[model samples]
Target: MSHGVKKRKLDKNAQESLYFDSYSDVTIHEEMIADRVRTSTYRAAILRNAEAIRGRVVLDVGAGTGVLSVFCAQAGAGRVYAVEACSIAEQAVKIVKQNQMEDRIEVIRGTVETIDLPESVDVIVSEWMGYALLHESMLGSVLFARDKWLKPGGLILPCRAELYVAPVSDPVVEERLNFWCTVRDQYGVDMSCMSDFAKRCILSGDIAVTPVTVEDVLSHPARIAELDLRSVTAEQLRSVRGEFACECFGSSAVNALCVWFTVTFPCEDNKTLVLSTSPFKPETHWKQAVLYLDEPTDVMQDTKVAGEIHMYPSEDSARHICIHVDYTIGEHKKHSKTFSIPDGYSEAQQ
Candidate 1:
């Protein structure tokens, strides 16, 4: 038996947050399912290890449309609990029934932190990564589910996750900044002064979720941090800090630090299946997070760029994240900046 929330009306802000947090919109689920890299990776991870799933009980945390639960059912799971916190749970029930998995899968409409399962699960599967991997704060719920319902030595899908960072030259950002200055001549007005203000507005300490090409990379990416989900604690995730150093490929205007993540699933054969959202790999809905510098730095070949990255949950919204970066371009040049992932980007913008 699972405890569920009773029907209740919520205010506007509460409603908005629920929608954003739960991804209640069908279109959002459509986009996520349509992402070949993301969906295929999870499918492969589950189907490849059918032996482990057979006759096992599974729990799908934050199961929006119950897709992962369906995958586990198809993989021969005896029972699957699909937990969701918003209206999407109703749809998930329909999706499970439509797929003729109602007997094997149970859709529970409530937050995982509050929901109760009939028995402990042998496996916990979730796609909780947000923009830059921690923007949405849903990992906390997954961790809670793990502590409460996961069996001893139970498996977690994509057991390992790593964050990477590197320098990049974003011509698109430079052109946008320069456009603010060029408008002075086109409009026959002294608008060049607004360039400084425009730069601040555009780069106002928010993670830019944009696409970057491999050619735009100015240096080899460094692995900043790694999380073993099985042992990682929420307290440790509150302030994930890492140090990285990279050498510039050549003289280039390094305008931003590109950040991305990769997750790996351990197989029964001792092999690992990886799903990377790096610019060097196929793009997912997460694209890549670019933290633009207030002013671009020019670096020469062999120029060493070293930095420390600090990430934490935002004070205003737990679902949002704040990133602080301190870096040096050369022996004498040091700079530090703080950025955040805006609520809109995590919500409607996505």
Candidate 2:
């Protein structure tokens, strides 16, 4: 089961920092639960699969407030282990008791990777997705849990996930970028030169979590990558690589590339439930990730924007991410750029 990729280990101080950054407050959990798209999807997925959950042992990774664990218990799970690594686990214990499922649900306050479970479980459930699907680094813990405690044929709540990208026209970003030039004209000063610096500051090589409308999408989205939770390893998540090709709908200025993800829950009778954070779909708390180019590129109908994307954890901080994109538009020369999610913006903003 070795993925053959060396996993980066975080030192004790870095681990503590990450833990505090992620779970220092209740606001983060509130935002997640308030996201109807995310919370409802898991609720429906679990309720729809009641047959699979009934009398089966289940594990909820990073079980914030034990919501998913409670859902499993309501679905008739024989026993539910809610594993949380932060102080929030203590709150989850109270929530489980308040719901009167104390006997069926046990809140374990520890990281799933190192936590001890009495026995293997029949299902693993987790709401571990971050902005752009990989920012928080929680999926790695879920994978570690799967390898250690999942039964041979146990189910994962979100069995499959897909990452997508497309060319987009972001007017807000365009206006912001244009503000630098406008300052020179409005104030009659030679401040236009700062436009380059402004672009750098705005496009700071990080994934911009912003709302993108369907009209903003200038091209058809291309599937950049996918992961099957049932078998994917933590090491395999260290780097994800894929090729994408998107065709412009018509002549338009492509200022940024938009990225989003869709996760699917398997159900009986060959059915599957999908939760999409696509711009065309209802918005989630995740919104969509926008990677701005240094400048806008013009494209005509049928213009092909093709590229390869490589996403991995940043070396300096495992919770942060580094993205390398190499792309070509129509007859244009290939361009490559590297983007990083800075340490401070890693989890706090998400």
Candidate 3:
């Protein structure tokens, strides 16, 4: 959906969506979402700030099932613009009516970019994070909405996010790689290295290797990037570049470096009321991003290493990421690189 003032469809598909047509061409995992509904920490701000919402104009993008919209209405919002993109928006309508507050909440069925908003909104609340906060890259659309619709002083929920990096050692990924090599070796003895086919799957299985949690990686994460929700746009977040130097804390076998970051929303106090990722959070859809050393690095305890990594978001529709990493451990130099989805690119990488 394109961002514009007039309420208009971007293409034929968008026009068809206006009818709330079923996706007969594609299969939806309805069974998977049957048991799920929704997050925490925002409850206090959402429930406690009754006055803030009481007479204010609010917008809820991707307001799946319309629960939050109803909450805003319950808080006395004068106009609650609830936007949803799924066919089940009818359920949200039913829920709104069951609560007996349809008068204050308006359910709009379309992408926020396509929906016509009457005027600027005082608040924009959205649950747009996807696995690690950038997976789907829907943040771009949100920014477009922010620039086009939010007035000065408008509030965006979960207002800050940070990216962190660290040196890590893990036995799991190494073991899995050896297992694949062994299996292929045995197959070659029988005049059928065709098992290379089986070995290939392990390489594509991003998680086939054991994952080193955030705790293992961040001895002390040197902050790389900190973004304020008050003003961040899709274009700006597309590429993250940084030069980071860290030390190998112990004699460790480094097959790859694991990188995971987090987003935190602060309360009135400086404390993080809700942290999205980083070392403090449980793994979300965003798995720890990896940069392999290709050939292992046997770092002596207490060696100084300087390195840098560049993360480029995929330009394709999939919104993947391509990562390049280079480093010098003590006197030894090593590197590894890989591209994101729709690709399995790997090189000697210097």
Candidate 4:
């Protein structure tokens, strides 16, 4: 490729990295129903514990495919506010009627952040777990709605949540570092060799450095960020920064970071409902994204290094949840992000 073409590709990868960095891989749309949504472990947790919804005013946030909302109605909610964005909101509307819940379930076709509600709810029912349970970052929207319309004592599904991190076995890291070293060498011979190095840097990694879900990082995860659903907010979620002092496993280059968290809500009978581990679950078609590190670092196990990560929500749309993560490992760094809708758009454009 020509010099300019390669530059464009590198820049494009960076942009995509940011756009998809925080998106989940589950799909709860019509196409994702039986195969993806209904059988999810997260959803299973909710149905297993249903006593919380009996005769309650429940608000279902991100009511995609209307699965969770319909379930809330079936659980005997006094009234179900099925709020959703995207065309799937129409599907949710149809599902409410198909389930003969048109009288009890109201479908609001807008983001949870700005939708209007007729009354305060007794409970908030939503499946907002993205890949790693926060990619779509829909929890912020849920929290916003709760603060605005949910009764003080109302229930929120996925009441408690936690993010875990661990060291894992990955060979991709070594390959990436070696490639970067090669590129640095070639640069001495030819300044034009820069483009090849950039592309190779994107591809090579013996250890893994992408922003993978924390679940994939270790067999058993260590809780990095534990959060409560009722009180967490978008502003508080702006940055996920932490310091890690551990070995890189030498073979592991620590190309990217993987982060995953879980949400737990209390259902009836003191049983807990969960999203990340339920037979019935919401769907996100996007796979857990891997945020490529801007740079890679190498070390061995028990190596002491500090790092910080961030997921920024775009202040742009009613439901815009974007992410930006920067990990400073040792002296090297890498970052990835998924843009919330862009911020600062004019009223007419918004």
Candidate lDDT scores, in order, read 0.87, 0.86, 0.60, 0.56
Estimate TM-scores for all models. 0.93, 0.93, 0.74, 0.66
Q: In what order do the candidates fall by lDDT, top score first?
A: 1, 2, 3, 4
lDDT of 2 by residue, 239-303 (tens): 89999999899988887888899999999757999999999999998899888887688999999
lDDT of 4 by residue, 47-136 (tens): 655666777888888777677777777667878888876666676677778889899888887777667787898888776665445543
Clashes of each: 0, 0, 5, 64
As a TM-score, model 4 comes out at 0.66
List, residue by residue over 1-350, the lDDT tens digit for candidate 3: 23365443245454334223332211222321231312444454555556656789988887766767777777778888888777667777887888887888888887788889998998777766543345444566577778888889876765676666666765665566556547546775442444455435434324211245754562455556666778876667777676777777777666555666665544444445554445455544344555555456777666666677666665443344555567767787565455343222111100
Best by lDDT: 1
- Angstrom error of the Cα, residue 304, model 1: value is 0.8
Candidate 3: regions farther than 4 A off: 1-38, 48-51, 74-76, 180-211, 269-272, 283-287, 334-336, 342-350
After TM-score superposition, the amount by which residue 91's alpha carbon in candidate 4 deviates from its true location, in angstroms, is 2.1
- Report residue 290 deviation for candidate 1 (angstroms): 0.7
- Model 2, residue pairs in steric clash: none
Residue 338 local lDDT, model 4: 39
In model 4, what is the error at residue 4, expressed in angstroms? 9.7
